[model samples]
Target chain A: MKMRMLLVAAAAILYSSSSLLMAEADGKWLARVPDEDKARVNPLAGQAKAAAAGKIIFEENCARCHGVDANGLHNRPSLRSERVRHATDGQLAWMLRNGNPYKGMPPWNSLPEQQRWQVITYLRTLPPAGAAGGKP
Target chain B: MFASPAFARVLSWAAVFLLPVPLLRAQEKPYFVTYSTDLEEPGNLEIALKGLTASPKDANAFFSPTMELEYGATAWWTTEVYAQGQATDNDSTVFTGFRFENRFRPLPREYFVTPVLYVEYESVSRADKSILEVTGHDGISSFQVNNSQSHPIVEHSLESKLILSSNFKGWNVSENFIAEKNLSNEPWEFGYSLGAARPLTLVASSQRCTFCLQNFDAGAELYGGLGTRYSFGLAQTSQYAGPVFDFRTPAGVTYSFSPQFGLNDNSIGTLWRFKISYEVQQIRDLFKSPSKRNAQ
Candidate 1:
């Protein structure tokens, strides 16, 4: 048990100092998205339950960084901001597929293209810069 | 102690219960040998227990358990440390040494075939049975001797891989080219692996419930050695191919399983492997930022 305690203590130390480096913010990724990519359309755009289905995926994959309300968390940017609210569905899809890695956001290309669009569909439902969560 | 089945079970159970308390991402791949281009989210840590059991025609049946702790320090880098152990049915269990690995993606965005560079340092005994990677005539002499005879040959090696992966529609295809060199005057070893996987369903159900078709992935991988630099062929090597399955829970837990069949005379008849992993996101923020804590 003493060894286990020592391991726990070491882990606590690591957990505390591990933050010495972490994810941060970037702005240039929006400009880097190719026009062709920006033109890609969301196939699930107008489906009635698309946003509802997207909310489930958004909560599973993005809520940790983006917040359940899509208002953003820590230093991560909010999806409810005017920039995101006005982003074309294709632009949002491009961002999801190609993250702002020059800063710290990892790409979500591992997710299916459909899931990326689904999350975008869900993002469209969030109110701008508020503490509300709804999908209708 | 770290390699025992009991210890592995305890760790897996702990991850299942403790790691799923909050929401997390679930785009993990299911391949056991081939790596894909997905890196852990930055500032997140993942803990996992992986095990392999195989009955080699040459040696006693044994189980090897590996404990892995992976951390994402940056968007393009994920680092992992592993503790390994092996136990035979009639023979005693022994703790093999450790391995440290880092995978880096230099690009800032997606490419036609995303590339990930991997480097790992391993200090393990000859008795090591995890068989994490098969490289260069490994099966010609693998498991040919008893653990007592092999355990004393402690060797240190450097392993590297060039991983290429692409996702089209809902399917993911990946390939890995491996090179390993022993620091103690051994020739370079080469290996390769290929994998393809897709989610059972592309469309997600509105409810985030377990047992949903979208939560599962099915895949397969083929891996084998390609002999040493001096003798560069498959003249004496082991090969295996197998199907893989992965189940991702909404609460940040992942379970993976595979059963591989050896494809050559030098290979083990069959191998079964399983792993359980948990993702803990932004743990630093969880501790340091009161504002972020409130938002969560």
Candidate 2:
């Protein structure tokens, strides 16, 4: 009985420590996504037409905080960074659905699913870090 | 393909309305009560100097200049104080009493339409023609003789507006429905404004230029008085419509100009409005108290 109780406490502590570490990662927001969501792929990816549509949506809805070029403004995070570039399509979509309010990002869940995918499609076209055309 | 004359006219108007819809939006103060749902950055100060000069067909020309100090108290809240004065040829220049105003936005994110609430308290003479808050003044002659008949006694009033704004396809459209009441005695009066504006260009050049077309915004507005609560028709109405031009400098200065033409005999024949403002919102990191700094 004594040994079982000791093992239970140990397991709880280990579980809590891992959660803390995961939430502390760069962007920290990455840990919030469940496995199923993190692996989903964008249906509209690589579609030039969808990307064109996304640009309009982004300008009207996202440009105020993320900036017209998606370079970020008013200390908002730049969507063209490595974290965004490396993030899976599902992860991006999930973030939009469930915003990290603590970080000042409002949920775009009100947007239609296809519209969200379209935004992801547009985002993928942005150059990675160190790209010449990126904002200074 | 060009269509018939009537169709062509309609298409031209549509093009004018739709061409700039995708341009990004920036905060700009309008000439009239047409307000966009833009809140100032947190803890920033913007000082604006604005003047409007009106010409009546057979009456004296007069101008009212107002100095407004606005502060962003929070992300969703802005507060302002105004001191107004008017001058007319062969008439005394009187310092109109001051006004206090506040605007609040309830939503945290952009939407198809955003609604903002505006409330203000003003104390001014009956002859004040700043038109900052258009209430019951319907005749052009009222503005012509405003500065001449300045009474020592001041009148207190409350004004409110339901400002509904929408940002879609990069175009921003705003409408203001206004109601005002005198503190002493009077039925609630009504007024309204409609405006549409967008930047001339949306694409930012890689090489920076100061006077680029992208920095200018051109739009038009229509506003008028809608009479009192008891009398809800256009029996004694005044209306005006005109183009507005705004230029924003990289150094945080904005200049706005507008020339308005009245549509009725009761309205002023021509009205010219100008506004210049300098904003100090960028130095937030260096300063601890912006309001205190402004006070100094």
Candidate 3:
């Protein structure tokens, strides 16, 4: 039994090492977001408190890939890029809820709806476009 | 493949020596006995060290320490391997055994209630006392046997669980129905566990703080065993209810504790548990999180 278990563990380790990471998709994923999700408005719109709360959430959950400044990191798309600045709240929410897992982002569905919205609100507070982030 | 048993052991132990990982799970789950629909994110590995101190009124108290390596096989599948050892007060200490477990999520998206499938294989002995769960007429009296005298009965078992979980607003509730069978002659045994938890506050503070209310999650869990196939009920079984709490730091570490009280005479008097976990980004060569992967 011990040997069999060892075999299983070893196989799992081998599989992980060889597993393929997220491959970049054609940047046209925006079209995949349903129209309804695109039209939805942010409930926490214009609330500084909500945006402030979201800043923390983004730091905790997103800074690794998105960069602490929310700019592009390595090949990761910047949350502060022109695309994100122009996206509707619903679109951003849709992206967070259903991550482009095929492209490497795991779904943030584990996060609560309120927190997701707070993050959206925080993103709204960032600079218009092509900026580092909201902070000075 | 490994050339020999010693090499395999070395490889397994070597995985532990390599460190540096963040626990994405700590932010989502606060219960020790029950599982939620939250699977490990793809390309992430979480390492957890948990210790259990079980106190039985009529038997010597024992402390069981467990090391778990949980890996995200994919977004829909998570696998874990556990090694455990037990040390008894005024008695001998023994290597309990190892458990391999996997959980699969069927649905790609979150719904009102999500269902996950769980299966595990345990290679252990009668002297093992991890008490990860209570199953099939398990009683406290059986735990009083001396470890030296009980280690010979090596029991191999397969256990499966139907995990139903949900997340609404900010709270997570989960229920698991368990069934187990011994490879030898034992009949099918049943068990169950339920858990519910939420962060102290759904809102996060703009500033990073270790002691913030948002960093803490509190919940409760109830678990117990049913009887064997011929006698399938809660009678002559062990049941426990406990309060669970966990604190997540800004540095990608989580600390969790639970104190469980036995509900019936068949159960142990008390059980205390503490766990610390960290996750390691697993996807490399192709992609890596912006951590210190270049050093590796």
Question: In TM-score terms, which candidate is top?
Answer: 1
Candidate that beats the other on DockQ, 1 or 3, i.e. the better one: 1
Question: Please, what are the lDDT tens digits per residue for candidate 1 over residues B168-211?
Answer: 98889999999999999999999999999999998888776789
Give the CAPRI class of candidate 2: incorrect
Candidate achieving the largest DockQ: 1
- Of the two candidates 1 and 3, the one with more favorable lDDT, higher being better, is 1
Error of model 1, residue B256, in angstroms: 1.2
Q: lDDT tens string, model 3, B70-127? A: 8776667788999987777667667878899998777655567878899999988888
- For model 2, residues B1-296, the per-residue Cα lDDT tens digits are 12234334433543453343222222464545588777554444677777787667776666677778776555566678788876665555667778888887766545567787999998888667677644455667666554545546688989999988775543568889999898888888888888887667543332335687656777898888889998876667888889988987665567789898888878887888887776554224243355533321
Ranking by lDDT: 1, 3, 2
Error of 3 at B216 (Å): 1.1
Residue A3 miss distance in model 2 (angstroms)? 73
Model 3 residue B100 distance off true place after TM-score fit, in angstroms: 1.3
* Docking quality category of candidate 3 according to DockQ thresholds: acceptable
RMSD in angstroms, all models?
4.4, 15.8, 6.5
Q: Any runs in candidate 2 off by more than 4 Å, and if so which?
A: A1-136, B1-26, B29-31, B146-148, B282-286, B289-296
Superior by DockQ: candidate 2 or candidate 3: 3
